[model samples]
Target: MAKHTTLKRGQLLKYIGKRWKNLNIISGNSFMKFLGYDGNGFADVWVEYQGRLLFLSIKEVELAV
Candidate 1:
């Protein structure tokens, strides 16, 4: 089951903008695809978007709608 999270939209953008490695959505996809990362230690699990910081669980990403 995916875990529902409620974070401000602005925070998500902040994490992406402030963090470079955190902005990587590719590694994240691979992890979500194959089930884990090779050695990059799963991409950013939390992000700031639109003045809100959204913390998401792995399950949530896998079940993202």
Candidate 2:
């Protein structure tokens, strides 16, 4: 199998699942370290593709648990 590294923003993709809902991506995790967030928290969503990698909001995810 080969890997594809050509993902664009706002592109509707799907994941291989039968009992889980997908979230939207407010901002990408490629560079969250540079973009600091406030205490109030901002909108965060998960960006994934089938069996590929999944990227979500580290802030909201941590707070959720």
Candidate 3:
């Protein structure tokens, strides 16, 4: 079985400036750096797959751990 957890706003804020592993499930990039909330129910993140710095918004979904 796959373990999943919901990412709350507080939790997401705590991970800012940190590398979040396994986030590639949404962008195909394994390690993503958590930036901050967009205040629009989406979390901004930096994908490591591409060299360029692009901000991607991640919707609130159950995270598979």
Candidate 4:
């Protein structure tokens, strides 16, 4: 069984320095580094995927903790 947790801003910091499973990536599945949210009033997650970093909406990905 897999343990899944909703990606929320409150636990964003905790995900830092750790690896999480992202099941909603465009390329099937991928491992993302949680770099926390941006400071634009909206909680956007900065994820590093496939050697490239990108900003993604909180609802755009399903994170498995």
Pick the TM-score winner. Answer: 4
* lDDT accuracy of residue 53 in candidate 3: 41
* TM-score of model 4 vs. true structure: 0.48
Model with the higher lDDT, candidate 1 or 2: 1
Top lDDT prediction, candidate number: 4
lDDT of each: 0.34, 0.33, 0.36, 0.49
**Candidate 2: tens digits of C-alpha lDDT, residues 1-65:** 01222333444433222233553334442221212222334333344333334544433333110
Query: Which lDDT tens digits does candidate 4 get at residues 1-65?
Result: 11233344333222222234653344434556666567654446776765666676655545545
Which stretches of model 3 miss by more than 4 angstroms? Answer: 1-29, 43-52, 59-65
Model 2 residue runs over 4 Å out of place are: 17-65
lDDT of 1 at 26: 43
Residues 1-65, model 3: lDDT tens digits: 11122244323211123346643343333443333444554444333333434455453222334
Model 1 C-alpha lDDT per residue in residues 1-65, reported as the tens digit of each score: 22233323222121112234454444333222222222334442553333334554334443233
Q: Compute each candidate's TM-score over C-alphas.
A: 0.24, 0.24, 0.28, 0.48
TM-score order of candidates, best first?
4, 3, 2, 1
What's the count of clashing pairs in each model shown?
A: 16, 0, 0, 0
Residue 30 of model 4 has an lDDT of: 52
Candidate 2: clashing pairs of residues: none
